[model samples]
Target: MKRPKTKSLVVYGTIAAILLMFWISWAGGIVPQVWQVNALLQDDPMLQEYPYKFRAVLLASGVATMTRPYDMEVAPFDFLQVIEPDLAGKAPNDPAMVAALKRLRAHERRAARVAVSHTAADGVEWVLDRAWYHKHGIKLPPKTLVY
Candidate 1:
């Protein structure tokens, strides 16, 4: 009887340990990264006015691993719904928020262009440049010219 009880205890302990590790990894790593991204976005003058929207976007982007400027082209509204459901519906009607969103989009586009230019020979740059071309309706020039 004691042996059976010991075996059950060991199994329960193993399951508990797994759960604890998952919680720790998420809370210690991902949560802090999300907060750091939010702080950075909040500090930006262009984004300061739209604190909630910025937070929503940052959290979603962090989860999606959307760290690159080109990755930000994903619509903020989708994330806003998850982060701040109450404000998501009203965002379209708010002129200030709309303007801020536009500014953020433009900034991301410029950043993506700069990143592509700086890393011209890299694989990442190749992908980013393709995206940039598609977004701006520009044709990709010859590979020789790209490098």
Candidate 2:
């Protein structure tokens, strides 16, 4: 019987190690753990925001799951219906719900602006405002996605 080459053995072992690391990271993602902690341990912010940020996180997680189907499940806003049937029809029209959504979107846009500004200052100038592009003679790229 011929012996396996050491080089091939080393390559296979390295590949296996990489796969194991990926699997472990996927299995141990922090989002679910955060949910569990907030739900069970009564974290004040998570409790007070009940179903707003929680719902947002769920939708975000669901979208993330779409990108990594094997590792995630899309348990989005509809899950709120399952858990709190009272919120189904009423939430859409509720002033508080609308205000919460607006607040969340504002927070997201503010964070995006801050990130773009920092990146631009750090020489990722392509993402900077059109004013910066014109100042530097870099043609502004057509807008793609907003956030």
Candidate 3:
């Protein structure tokens, strides 16, 4: 059989390289958030108080994995508004939920600050999408969960 032409091989190689870069950028952006969220879910006393409830909130909020595109600023607590009715009778001010929200917000912020310590850090996936915010003339960090 005849071997593939050099031109064809180069084209295929270039495509693969581009795909790899995109994959890296996407994963880099999401992995850190996932790591931070999971870590909080596992270790935060408030979150652990009602693991199932918190997990349900995370899933329902579409922030469970924290991997969705442009999901850097999403947190489990952000969905509190949408889910207030469902939880109004139960955990509106549940100590665990409130504490968890505060802790998670702080944790996310610190992670973002660390991940984007330098200007060049913007090239990768940023927690809180800090790079995107900066590009849009928003100099402040992401908003936090309100009690």
Write candidate 2's Cα lDDT for 66-115 as tens digits.
01001122222233343355556655547744654455445434332332
Ranking of candidates on TM-score, top first: 3, 1, 2
Count the clashes in each prediction.
Answer: 0, 0, 1
Residue runs of model 3 more than 4 Å from their true location after superposition: 1-75, 78-89, 122-147
* RMSD after CA superposition, every candidate: 12.7, 15.7, 12.4
Q: TM-score of every model?
A: 0.28, 0.28, 0.29
Compared with the true structure, what per-residue lDDT tens digits does model 3 show for residues 31-64?
4444444554455555344322221112212233
Candidate 1 residue lDDT tens string, 10-80: 99999999999899878644455445544554456654453233231222321312242223234444433
Candidate 2 at 7: error in angstroms? 4.5
- State the weakest 10-residue window (summed lDDT) of model 2: 64-73
lDDT of 3 at 132: 37
Candidate 2 ranges beyond 4 A from true positions: 1-4, 7-87, 120-147
**Candidate order by lDDT, highest to lowest?**
1, 3, 2
Which residue pairs show backbone clashes in model 3? 29-125
Structure candidate 1, residue pairs in collision: none
